[model samples]
Target: MRNSVLLLAMGMLLATGQPGLADDAELIKNTKADHEENGRWYTSDDIPTYKIAEDGTVDWPTFSGFRRYNAECFQCHGPDGAGGSYAPALATSVMNIDYYKFYETVVNGKQEVNAAQNLVMPALGENKNVMCYLDDIYSYLRARGTGDLGRGRPAKKEKKSEAFTENENACMGE
Candidate 1:
């Protein structure tokens, strides 16, 4: 009778699925769903295409971001963040990027690693809605600057004077 009971217990263990297996599958499914959502979060439709209309109405908080960027970051980043050579161009930077990243970098600041001119950014956590401002500032800069903001690299520079010849008659196509 004892041997029979042991056999039965072994059968049950084999027949029943192991505990926590379902949880793993559920976790995988949840993770996949989250990735899908993240992929769509930055779609073009989600982000506004135009910064300012011809009439000169700037996007909300974006204008504020511009003010803050100019006041706080322009010195190192340049007027439009194209680059200054002395400092990494925000337009072309691959580090501490994006609204969330920029906001965090600004608010928390950063530690200088190599004693380069780059200084630790002071935390602007005190600033209200700085994230939104950073987002708008990013949009404005990306819209005006030449580069892919998503890639965090500037577009290759084109040859200058290609379009217009040295001759005054170049536009006439003579």
Candidate 2:
């Protein structure tokens, strides 16, 4: 009956080694950079994503993201968003949770406490460093989550755009 069909479908998916194939397709589509402004790339849905050159050059914002994440987030999320004893892998689920939720969570923070565990992420809404480069952080995590960018520092990166430099200065109150 229906359960048998469902089981068959699940088995087929596993056998083919394409777990969540449909989800993968959607992820690919949603993460494709449709445009760029000030050296940052965004998908058609307005979510951040990394852009890489054929010669292995990463976009500036993505590089900025790596720096920002390491500076602001790695303490809990572990190096390269790989997760740690203290936090889940942001790189693993950022894409799955989607951009809006990620933005909301980072800005407002989240807390869960119980006998088994207590988890909390402090709000970064007022942190100029994080808030200013939120998109870049998302772009970097998305790239890592999607396997588009590997761990460690990117060797080649495009020069930061003047607009990005100006915006960063303004946001940071420099």
Candidate 3:
């Protein structure tokens, strides 16, 4: 009976374009009372929402930046972001496209340069953070490997050491 009354009152409120002062008060009271009992009216301050920029770039760094290079470019570019046998290494590529040109292609997706290669890149967008990340990736690639960003660890090499001994002919009695 109480539920029916509440529903009827809400329905009447909806039907009436202009709710009176008492109606509004009743609505608020009912909502608060119900919410207090059900705990369904709580508000959350944080929500994850992706906002794409006008240029199609993501507002935040996509894949935190590195992942973008890895997922979209690493296949042909190699782990270092340097072009492999299948593609031109980023560091030494003749394209020499600076951040702006590179950004254009990234935001616009594939371009018609070297159509014979049949490569079709997709746009990433003009999101400042994302673009900044791209710059970081570029910096990483510029440092050495085609992969943008600084090399995390130096390449390893085998070490050799020797000592002279009285019993050994190679060392003699040094």
- Highest lDDT scorer: 2
lDDT of each: 0.46, 0.88, 0.42
Candidate 2 displacement at residue 58 in angstroms:
0.4
Better of 2 and 3 by TM-score: 2
Displacement of residue 72 (Cα, Å) in model 1 is: 2.1
**Stretches of candidate 3 above 4 Å error?**
1-68, 112-116, 126-132, 145-174
Model 2, CA-based lDDT: 0.88
What would the per-residue lDDT of candidate 2 be over residues 81-148, giving only the tens digit for each residue?
89989899999878678687889999999998899999999999999989999999998998898788
lDDT ranking of the models: 2, 1, 3
Error of 1 at 97 (Å): 3.7
lDDT for model 1, please. 0.46
TM-score of each: 0.43, 0.82, 0.37
User: Per-residue lDDT tens digits of candidate 3, residues 1-174?
Assistant: 999999999998788848566654343222111111111111121111122233433322222334446656677667655567665666553124444555676678764567376665556675443443454344334334322224433232112112111112232222
Q: For model 2, what is the error of residue 82's alpha carbon versus the real structure, in angstroms, after optimal superposition? A: 0.7
| Superposed Cα deviation of residue 71, candidate 2 (Å) | 0.6
Show model 1 residue runs off by greater than 4 Å: 1-63, 94-98, 115-118, 129-132, 146-174
- Number of the top-ranking candidate, with TM-score as the measure: 2
Worst lDDT 10-window in candidate 2? 19-28
- What TM-score does candidate 1 get on C-alpha atoms? 0.43
Model 2 steric clash pairs: none
Candidate 1 all-Cα RMSD: 17.6
